[model samples]
Target chain A: EDKVVQSPLSLVVHEGDTVTLNCSYEVTNFRSLLWYKQEKKAPTFLFMLTSSGIEKKSGRLSSILDKKELFSILNITATQTGDSAVYLCARTPNNAGNMLTFGGGTRLMVKP
Target chain B: DAGVTQSPTHLIKTRGQQVTLRCSPISGHKSVSWYQQVLGQGPQFIFQYYEKEERGRGNFPDRFSARQFPNYSSELNVNALLLGDSALYLCASSPGTSNNEQFFGPGTRLTVL
Candidate 1:
């Protein structure tokens, strides 16, 4: 079975602080990894990492994948209250078609 | 263009009851997928349909079934619901089946009593 595990199940930080979330996966055929931010109901797309050592960035958020280690990290710099949400990491296997196997997610709480 | 849309944003059901949730994909999208998100857990893939045909399915029980329409809309039906069936049912749509990112709906919150 394909499995994805995220570290630091929950985190609390004040505004302006920086936080890093981790995700590691074990799958037979890894194709890509994706990150999402969920506030209330739906998760919003963040980044999709396909190649190792290459980083994808957006605003204060950036993510990098390490295919060699089968892990990824999401970094949020200068975190704001609006950044408080669940960060989800998902993996797409080559054989799964388009199905995404997601990690349990890391709950981030940014205090103002 | 509008994002993915789901009908009956919320629902309440009792044990042994059946429920059907609807989803309308984003304009021009041809693939739709269903997921179940239990509290404090990540969303689990249930089914994926493209061109009105079943493309993939997860490990969910036979009680869970889905179908897509010609227009790209879809419906998920769960029969003989148990309390464990209560969760947020999310519908996502993508332009095609290959390597495309999916856009999610607000999700239907189902509570089984």
Candidate 2:
């Protein structure tokens, strides 16, 4: 069975602190990886990475995938209270337009 | 364009009663998927429909069923509900089969008594 795992189930940091959330997956046929931020309801899209060594970034958030290691990492810079949310990592498998297997997620709390 | 949308922000039902949750995909999106999220846990896949056909299903029980309409809207039905069936049902829509980026709705919170 395919699976996704995330580390540091929860984190607390100062406003300017930088945080790194980790996600690793073991799937039959790898396709792509996606990141989402959830506050209280639906998850908003963040980034999608398919190739290794190449990083996809947006504003203060960035992510990269290491297919060789079957893992990915999301980095947030200059964090703010508004950035506090649950970060979810999911892996989509090849061969089908199917569901994404998500990690437990990293709950981030940023304080000013 | 409008994003994916779900109905009845919240609901309450007794055990053994049936429930129907609705979803409207983002305009121009041909695929719709449903997921169940329990508090403090990641969303669990339940069903995926594209172009009015079932594309995939999760490990949920037979009591859980869903279908997509010609307009690309969808509905999820849960029969013989139990206390364990209570959860937040999320709907997502994508433009095509290979599109991995799905837009999610606010979700419908279902409570089983």
Candidate 3:
């Protein structure tokens, strides 16, 4: 079975703080890793990492994947209260369809 | 462009009852996937439909089924619901079945009593 494990299930940080969320996976075939932020009902897309070492960034948020190490990390620099949400990491396998296996996710609470 | 959309934002059902959830993918999208998310847990893949064909299915039991229409809309049906079936059901859509980023719907919150 393909499994994804995320570290620090929950974290609390203040404004302007930097936080790193980790995700490690064990899969037979790896296609890509994706990150999402869930605030209320829906989860918004964040980043998709396919290659190792190269980091994908968007403003204060960035992520990197290490295929050799079978792990990925998402970093938020200078966090704000609005950034508080559940961060999800999912792994897609190399198959006919894009079936995602997701980690339990890290709940982030950014204080004002 | 409009994102993926799901119907019936909330629902309540008793055990042994049946429920059907509907979803409409984004315009021009040909692939749709269904997921179940319990509180405090990541969403679990339920099924994936591409071009109206069943491409992938998760470890869910036979009581759960889904189908994609020609218009790319889909419906998920669950029978003999148990209390454990209560969760948020999410629908996602992509351009194709390949490596594409899926956009999720608001999700349907189902509470089984």
Candidate 4:
């Protein structure tokens, strides 16, 4: 069975703190990894990582995939309360017809 | 362009009843997928349809079925619903079946009584 595990299921931090969320996966025919920020309804796309070592960044958020280690990490720098949401990591396997297997997700609460 | 849209934001049904959820993919998107999400858990894949054809399906039981229309809209039907069938049904759409990013709908919250 394909599995995606996320660490630190929940986190609480004050504004301006940096946080790192982890995601590890065991899947067959791995294709790509995706990150999403879910707040209230529907998950909004954040990043998609397909290669190792190369980091994808959007403003204060960044993510990198380590295929050798079968894991990925999402880093948020200078966080704000607006960053409070559940961060989800999902993996797409080849021949799966674009279906994604998602992790339990890390719930982030950034305080003001 | 409009994003993925789902109908009946909320629904309530009794056990043994049948329910249907609807979804409309974004304009120009040909692929639509269904997922079920329980509280505090990640969404689980249910079905994927593209170009009016069934492309992929998840581990869900035969009681859960779906079909795509010619216009790329889709409907998910669940028969003989059980108490455990209560969950948030999500619809996602992508441009193709490859590695494209999927856009998700707001989801329908189904409550079984």
Displacement of residue A12 (Cα, Å) in model 4 is 0.6
What is the clash count of model 4?
Answer: 0
Residue range B1-113, candidate 3, lDDT tens digits: 78889999999999999999999999999999999999999999999999999999999999999999999999999999999999999999999999999899999999999
lDDT of candidate 4 over B1-113, digit per residue (tens) = 78999999999999999999999999999999999999999999999999988888899999999999999999999999999999999999999899999999999999999
Residues A1-112 of candidate 3 have per-residue lDDT tens digits of 9999998999999999999999999989999999999999888999999999999999999999999999999999999999999999999999789978999999999999
DockQ of each: 0.75, 0.77, 0.91, 0.83
Clashing residue pairs in candidate 3 (N, C-alpha, C atoms within 3 angstroms): none
TM-score for candidate 3, residues paired by index: 0.99
Please report the candidate that would top lDDT against the real structure: 3
Q: List TM-score per model, in order.
A: 0.99, 0.98, 0.99, 0.98
> Distance from true position, residue A73, model 4, in Å?
0.5
* Residue pair clashes in candidate 2: none
lDDT of each: 0.95, 0.92, 0.96, 0.95
Model 3: runs farther than 4 Å from truth? none
Q: Answer with 1 or 3, whichever has the higher DockQ.
A: 3
lDDT of 2 by residue, A1-112 (tens): 8989998899999999999999999977989999999999999989988899999999999999999999999999999999999999988878778577789899999999
Evaluated with TM-score, which candidate comes out highest? 3
- Candidate 1 per-residue lDDT, tens place, B27-68, comes to 999999999999999999999999999999999999999999
Interface C-alpha RMSD after superposing true interface residues, each candidate, one decimal? 1.1, 1.1, 0.5, 0.9
The structural similarity of chain B in model 2 to the true chain B, as TM-score, is 0.97
Model 1: per-residue lDDT, tens digit, A8-92? 9999999999999999999889899999999999898999899999999999999999999999999999999999999999998
What local lDDT score does residue A59 receive in model 3, on the 0 to 100 scale? Answer: 98
> Candidate 1 falls in which docking quality class?
medium
